[model samples]
Target: MTQAENERRGNVPPSNKRYFYRTYGLTIASQLELPELPKAEATSQPDVVVLTPGVAEKLEGATFRKGWLEMGDDRCQITIEGVARYRVEDGQRILLDRRVPREVDPVADPGDIRLFLLGSALGGLLHQRHWLPLHVSALKTPSGVWAFTGHSGAGKSTIGAWLHYTQNWPLVTDDVAVIKPHEDIPYLHPGPPRVKLWKDALAALGIQTEGLVRDLTREDKYHLMLNKGFQDHPSPLKALVMLERAEEGEAASLERIRGVEAFKSVMATLYRPEMGTEFNTAEQLMRESIKLAGKIRVYRFRRPWSLDQMNSSIEPLLHEIKQ
Candidate 1:
């Protein structure tokens, strides 16, 4: 019988295994094991639950549609053409619907499902919960947690990896940096323990890509889990450094930004900013951004982008952080 038929007839056998994971300050109870996230003790009532694959359901009265995503107030439906369909509801549950048959696709190779689950689905859930998710890589230092943010290919991951591998800073999070809303100080929550790097970035760090899990969407990129330098707890926000590529032969520079520009910079780093609009969360996000701008320091760091100058470019930022 086909997968859909089995679901229709209620013939799908329930798996006995259960997994618990912690990420973005939330405890998750899932039917599938997520190797990217650090394991947590099982909880009777987790903050989120990821259900096993079953029948797909249509979302009613979706207010926004963009590409493969449909978003409403408390629910989101994401359809990846050939892979799977995911529904995130009320900031608490995730329902998976695999497009491919089970016989054709084994459970062992769940990279595609994991990719969207951790990326788009989780982002939507964060929106539902009213947390600020920034597109940045972050690390915890003695002072506090510092984050790097910029446009894609702007060296956020590269700098973050360099600092972790060479400087021995514990990695707090990668890709999506979750900030809990607060009245006084902004706190960053730890995310999945893995970092995604391109082949060239790995080579620049003198690390081999063998045995690394390839990113399902990008063949040249791979996910590397930090076994030793992973921080799994929330930390107070320190500073946010915005990276910009400098002209050839130009020296690296770091300058502190304040007031309106700082607020705009933080707003620009939002993960899936359109979700704020669709969920009618723009005003709250703006208020939080303003609070974040007032509480933390923001800096613009301009440096050369070549791999050869990676160390020289990063040193000044480290020195500035120490000051």
Candidate 2:
């Protein structure tokens, strides 16, 4: 898409008529034509439709719990009801006149709000190693596409934020990268083009907070939008790094981990949960991801998240990989 075209269609806001909430991946589409988006906080339902290019994945054993809301993006609609979130496949016309949310205290603070939504998220961040979706964080540098992998709090956002801060690199995608494997050179579907890091971490990265969006999740958690006032670019992936955290001095160095061990690392960093995306999707994603790993170098990176450890341990690894 041309810059002029993207400039014409700015970001849409949330609507009171509808809400959007989900854990599945989506493909931003072009056929969507909406009059206007509702002006409200980033709540559950938005009256307007979002455009995505990726295919909508369904969830298994989904149930409508209290405090859940349904969010739709053209090809996908996620009803985040109760503890289990459901991915509704058919995107037929929604009856907005019948739209009714259970109830939520809009004036509540982040922590209290989080309490209300926990059942909706249903311990999303606590999934087992084999269940999480294999999400990718990547950038489009002049040299090649750089992709990073990790579980929640595995520091994918932290590291991706740091790279964007210090180096001024253009990001390809973050949080999710829909893969189309086996094309000789594996490529990631153009994703959200940004990853929101914690504000304190952003400050520590030495990048001034210019136009970042502050998304407050419940409790002590907050995410900062990195694409604030930035542009998007499409690029092919070059290197894939699977991350794992350890004690300050645990990892002696970033070694070339290979064979099943390498595949295991890739599996460990997935982002989607088990209920929404099944084992078959996991196997397919892994097959494509492993192919990418086979073509390019896949490194298992272990590092402490502290400032000292980040620089002393992980910095060297980045330097080594870039070479």
Candidate 3:
């Protein structure tokens, strides 16, 4: 029967058993089985609950309305054209509305939905819960968790993939670094045990992408799931390494950032800084940023852009972390 007919006859039933998963230090019970996240033990009370697909209601009294997004005091609605509409409320609940006409099979067709679920929706929820999410890929070392933050194509994931695959360092998270603020030291929560690597990166790392899952948005990028070497718990954040492209043929250097420059650099790494402004006060963000800057050491690492220098580029960071 057609999907439309199934819907019309009320034959598309939601899953009877909710799936429990964990990421970024939160337990989630989701109607959809998200294989991208690590499975968690069943819990009666989860930190977040993801409901089944349903009609999305208009956010009442939305204070911020822009292209494809609406935000209120405690709720956010994100409409991705031709994909799905998501509602994240009070940092606890998430509701999905499928925009595509395909059959409702969460397991088989969860790539696109899971992408946004872990991206914009989760980012919004984190902001609401007062956690700082930075755009970084992290790996756990003997000292502590080291996070790499930089612009796109700055080799964050490539470096991370190299270390995880070659050096046996456990990957903490990829793409988004979740920070739980504290007085003495902030903590970094582990995210999904996957790294999205471009084709060239995979080749550079001597990895075969035959069975790897392709990224939904990037045609040339594939998701590499680390089943073995993955940090699955929260760890005290050690340092922030900011990667920058150095002049061709110039030697790589690592230097410490201090005072105002450190604070500004940390602020620049915020994964959705606008969400912080919308869901939280400027004073709140400032306070957290200041706390993070004061507590953590931020290092600026400049390296040549060539792939040949990838190993040499990581040397400076590895040496610095050992100190």
Assess every candidate by TM-score. Answer: 0.91, 0.60, 0.91
Put down candidate 2 lDDT per residue, 227-319, tens digits, no spaces: 342234344566678777877557535667777776676666555444333323456656754765576667877787675556566665667
Q: lDDT of each model, Cα atoms only?
A: 0.82, 0.46, 0.82
Once fitted onto the true fold, the runs of candidate 2 whose alpha carbons sit more than 4 angstroms away are 1-77, 81-87, 90-98, 105-134, 141-143, 206-218, 226-233, 250-252, 273-286
Give per-residue lDDT, candidate 2, residue 274.
Answer: 43
What are the per-model C-alpha RMSD values against the true structure?
3.2, 10.3, 3.0
Q: What is the lDDT of residue 86 in candidate 3?
A: 84
**lDDT of model 3, residue 32:** 74
Tens digits of per-residue lDDT for model 3 on 113-191?
6788888999999988988998888988878888888888787898788877777888998888688875356888877
Tens-place lDDT per residue, model 1, 169-217, is 8998878868878525588886777788889999999999999989877
> Model 1: which ten-residue window has the lowest total lDDT?
100-109
Deviation in Å, model 3, residue 310 alpha carbon: 1.3
Return the candidate ranking by lDDT, descending. Answer: 1, 3, 2
